[model samples]
Target: MARKTLRIAMNGVTGRMGYRQHLVRSLLAIREEGGLDLGGGDVLWPEPVLVGRREHALKEIADRHGLTEVSTDLDAVLADDSIDIYFDAQVTAAREQALKSAIAAGKDIYTEKPTATGLGAAVELAQAARAAGIKHGVVQDKIFLPGLLKLKRLIDGGFFGQILSVRGEFGYWVFEGDWQEAQRPSWNYREQDGGGITVDMFPHWEYVLHELFGRVRTVQAHVTTHIPRRWDEKGKAYEATADDAAYGIFELDGGVVAQINSSWATRVNRDELVEFHVDGTEGSAVAGLRNCRIQHRATTPKPVWNPDLPATESFRDQWQEVPDNADFANGFRAQWELFLRHVALDEPYHWDLAAGARGVQLAELGLKAAAEGRRLDVPELAL
Candidate 1:
């Protein structure tokens, strides 16, 4: 059977996530023309017509990838009847507007996280997409992660029986303010431009919790902007108005408690271990980016209560690296394939606009809690 051709118009195809989508498109083009397949069926291949600002950059990207269908005008691309989907990786503040326009144009949509800058906007966006009868999805990439996948399998298989709680450790030490140029994007430190760790990373943990444990019922958070100022790439200094780190404690629907510590001030110890250590009645699992290891009661080391003993030598053999059997794409690429399957084949895909709204909900609640110093209930936000 000839593969169905999907004409996609991408917004923010020149940004970081945009470049990622472009690379994926280039790979898809290779597969469409029949080249690389680290092997599964034809899930990854799609015809991506790139779109972005700046004719020179767009032309360079398209020419480099051998793609001719490139555009600078987003509305023009949306107006074209040939475009099957509207893809977005633009800044978060522009997401609702972009998706709103695309849905109005009657196109299926895929975009990066937080979907909307606020919960109200996110809810409206979801409603708009549903009313338009167009398929929609956001990039919930962590679920597709190999380590997280293994942890999910264990949780599903009851290896972690009677799951109790979860603790997530995620952060990296950004560059010093005075010594060097800016380490992160300028918008990241400014709250006005859809910046902050609370908005950026909580949505991620929200999906992770929803996927692994259950829906979050409430959130109690303490957010901080440790680095009051930062320098950009050109040594231009700017006041850091957004929180660089956030500590959130969540109450899941099933009484499962989870804590997430997100920061930009911690040093990277192990290739930046974005990990979750889940403790349950029967076992405990630690899932990092590269590996997922578990320790059951049967495998846990016996401790003689020596306070002087070094931490590294205490339980050396309790953890075992998970075996990798599935041929998986990076979290983003995996969601990209899933969204394509959802749109092209009408296959069941879970990460819809409602899920995206839930992410926004968590983020908003976390921020509210941080600002007001109170626990915020979030049952109304659950999907």
Candidate 2:
């Protein structure tokens, strides 16, 4: 078997998500598995070149993983013709310039979404990638989640005759760094640092709703900073300037109405950190990160509202679980595999920079709608 290598310049792996999901779970996993089988005796391998501002952190990662390439100079890395791809998982404020630099260097581009801080910049990145004639992709990892995969199966199988509505609850309390160390980075709570629940989550919602049900036509939202003060990485107190919560209503193309409440301030009492309850003409389903349960219209229970009577039925047990018919990989890794195939074999790939731009547009519009206290139409976005 002949081996082929694609040297990749990876930025921002020091961040939690970038390190855990992309570097460890995805790329390294591929390398450990002896690369992806590209058929015809050619095996595609990914060689990661760790790139970051922090030398000590990057060196630590390289030493820990036995990776050979490490660089702080992005321009120097870009100038290398051996580097096949440039991947960015950096802070939103810095992503635009990095992506443009990668594009100019003629590298195939892939990155975490909200590709830029604003819609216009996102559109520009998409245009640049297109003009460069290089393969490009965005990480829309939620679509590959097992629960949502089952939901997609249901929809495709026509189990849901017509999806009427969707309601979702997603959140868990993040311990303020004062009492206990915050699980998430403190920068997530500062607006000036390009952080907020609306900016962070609405993009996920845009694709989740669009890919699962229909195109989101309009958005109405109430976004607020539920936590006004929190401690940072250094344990110093700072005024939290970003929204920690957002309540959103989206009208989809097929008259499907969806309402979602996203928060970091609320404590959880649900089965999962995030769950979406979908209602349809013939059936209904509730899907979380790993589990999905469904109740057909015929099996749905009927209960009379009587405050005086104790409930006899267990509503939770009424639905049937959706079995995992196929083995599933980490959502991030699964997307990575597809992207590698797309690049190596010119496979049909749809989730590109354009999709990412739409996500950014939705988040931007969501924030605007919240500020204006109005329902705003989501016009068709074009490059």
Task: TM-score each candidate.
Answer: 0.92, 0.99
Top model number, TM-score: 2
- What TM-score number comes out for model 2? 0.99
lDDT per residue for candidate 2 within 1-383, as digits (tens), equals 88888888999999999999999999999999899889998999999999999989999999999997899999999999999999999988888999999999999989997888899999999999999999999999988999999999999999989889999999999988998999999888999988888888888999999899989999999999888999998999999999999999999997999999999999999899999999999999999999999999999899899999999989999999999999989999999989989998999998999999999999999999999999999998877
| Weakest ten-residue segment in model 2 by summed lDDT | 193-202
Count of clashes in candidate 1:
2
Candidate 1's C-alpha lDDT?
A: 0.82
lDDT of each: 0.82, 0.94
* Candidate 1 lDDT over residue span 248-301, tens digit each: 999997799999899998887653359898998889988987588888978777
- Candidate 1: the clashing residue pairs are 173-266, 182-232
lDDT value for candidate 2?
Answer: 0.94
Clashes found in each candidate (C-alpha, N, C closer than 3 A): 2, 0
